[model samples]
Target: MSSYKSIPVTMIETDVSYHKPSQTFRESVTLEDSALEVMTDFTRVTAISINPCASLEQARERMVSSGVQMLFVTNQYHEVMGLITVNDLNGPKPMQAVSENGGKMEDLMVRDIMTPRLKLEALDYEDISHARVGDLLETFKRMGRQHALVVEKDTSTDKQIIRGVLSTTQLSKQLGYQVQSSHMAGNIAEMAQGG
Candidate 1:
């Protein structure tokens, strides 16, 4: 039999707040910084996700509550089926979908507007590891996307896994300059000015 002693404990104090999960980045970064410095590594942070059958409103609510602009659409098995972004919820896509599919806006599902996995593109984790923030920004500009995914090969399974995510919004906050989505700007300077 093992004997144990109780340690002294203190009573909970009022007005004491709990710590929230937070990711730390450099206070500021230049475009020449490593791309990894700007990426949200899924290994460190849980990726926010929504079910494919979830309503658009539900997806929006989840994004707002989670403090993220994007959510991965997962199936019951938790496989990535697609992804939905704030733009997809607020842009003309919803209306267009309703118009084309003969459904009410309220009837729309996340999958109705999400970018399917087959249509998505990702950066190789190895390439990103060797790339600079500037290179990533240029890639975003060239691809006309606001967000980019990084995928790494799982050696054991030999399958690609979503390793991290990079967003222009996060880049803008780090750089202390607005970085407009590629669809919204012709160049970095234009992006800053546009914002």
Candidate 2:
């Protein structure tokens, strides 16, 4: 082994351009900033989920306990298969299932009443850059959705990932106002009448 000499280390400065300015941090943000700012990013909140085979009553209980209007129905591998919402429970799906099967609410499965994943629509996270809260509110109203999923292309994995969610209820609470959905009536006759 050879004897080694120790040298004093000098502090290395990072490139100033790489750092964000303090003013940028101090700037007051508004709902108009970007949809991303208003969105509940996955990094901050975990998606609430339920098993697809669970009973409608169980699903309702889970939703009540989770304090979410909807729950992602997952399979054995924990992959999203569909989604169940308070609307589905309070609507005709469960009743139709009960009528068809001649069984009680407990006999109705979440999968039977869930809105399949294929029917779900998502917005690109990049699109949020130019999107405003008002725009999102309008979209929710037009689409008759309480929540909207935001998908982002992960650079590292080179895959599209569900990155965030925007909720009308949450946004309304934050804004201190109610954002009503245009599809609230949700009657088939009204729907067929071009509502």
For each candidate, the alpha-carbon lDDT, in order, equals 0.88, 0.74
TM-score of model 1 vs. true structure:
0.86
Task: Please provide TM-scores, in order, for all candidate models, with all chains considered together.
Answer: 0.86, 0.72
lDDT of 2 by residue, 1-195 (tens): 879988999876886344422211212234455666567677666788899888888988998976789888888787778788899999999889878878787778898899998998999888876887656766786787888888888889998778877777776665555556764334323422442
* Model 1: CA > 4 A from native: 5-21, 183-195
Deviation in Å, model 1, residue 26 alpha carbon: 1.4
Model 2 CA lDDT for position 55: 84
- Model 2 ranges off by over 4 Å: 1-31, 183-195
Model 1, span 6-38: residue lDDT tens:
899999999998765667888778778898999
